[model samples]
Target: MTDTPENGAAAPTAAPQITSRVLAQYIRDMSFENILAQKGVTGDAQPEIQVQVNLDARKRSTDNQYEVITKLNITSKTKEKGDPLFVLEIEYAGVFHVEGVPEDQMHPYLLIECPRITFPFLRRIVSDVTRDGGFPPLNLETIDFLALYRSELARRAESEKAKAN
Candidate 1:
């Protein structure tokens, strides 16, 4: 037993902890399309583009690691009820080695942090694919990961409340 100089309490001697996150990243899946099947399908009006995004995270059985995936789907059409111009879909995933993160913090870390690291690559891919598909490069805007995470939490809470009712 040892005593501290001021309070007469022994301080435990332990090595400092090290926390690691996002060890590696890679594109798990990607897809692009030009439904029009023609180089320039220029019509009288510019096509309307719709973008949809989704995110999911899960823990690995190996422990202290997680898999995070971000998927993006885009569609372009002349109007609400018109022939589709082009469709693009991408599913990107990353393997993250998270350590020393509390259970409460793990969810946000995976959904927000992991996606932040992976989005740039995904964005570049989208741009390249659209360019090669014979259209102007589609540069995706930066996603609001924090807002997405919060919305997901709210959705889950609403679902649980509905179940209770």
Candidate 2:
């Protein structure tokens, strides 16, 4: 966006646009707690840390296409509280609607834009959960939405190419 003016006459801008509106949002579900049972890991389990992560996204079929939802879950386990730690599972998902929009624009917005809008809350949740679990806040690393978008496109392209062949 830019302002253009000459001779003190301002160019008229287009009418106000509301891209998407939140229909309804509430905590779908949430849980956070510390597992004191973890202490037994040091006595019996192998000295190993296990980690797994996943991501999923979906869009509503309604015409408005203005509603989006995302959830992130992370579970960590270590050989012992004082030993190396690992993320047993990190499942993140997003639901979005981009109706009345051009496909070219919506693709990136869903993959990148929506996440940009939602990541802060997700990050705060992660940090708070970790801290409440008796560990230092899990200040997550930054994400590159553009890179993720490119990767999604590449994956789709590869899948289509494979189908064609």
In candidate 1, list every pair of residues with a backbone clash.
none
- State how far residue 60 of model 1 sits from its true place (Å): 2.3
Task: Tell me each candidate's RMSD, in Å, in order.
Answer: 4.0, 6.4
Please list the residue runs of candidate 1 whose C-alpha ends up more than 4 Å from where it truly belongs after superposition.
1-18, 38-42, 79-81
lDDT of 2 at 143: 65
Which pairs clash in the backbone of model 2? 65-97
lDDT of 1 by residue, 40-103 (tens): 4556535688889999888888878889999889988876456778899888888888786667
The lowest-lDDT stretch of 10 consecutive residues in candidate 1 is: 38-47
- Listed in order, each prediction's TM-score against the native is 0.79, 0.57
Per-residue accuracy of model 2 over 69-99 as CA lDDT, tens digit each: 4444455555454443323223333444444
Looking at model 2, residue 64 earns an lDDT score of 50
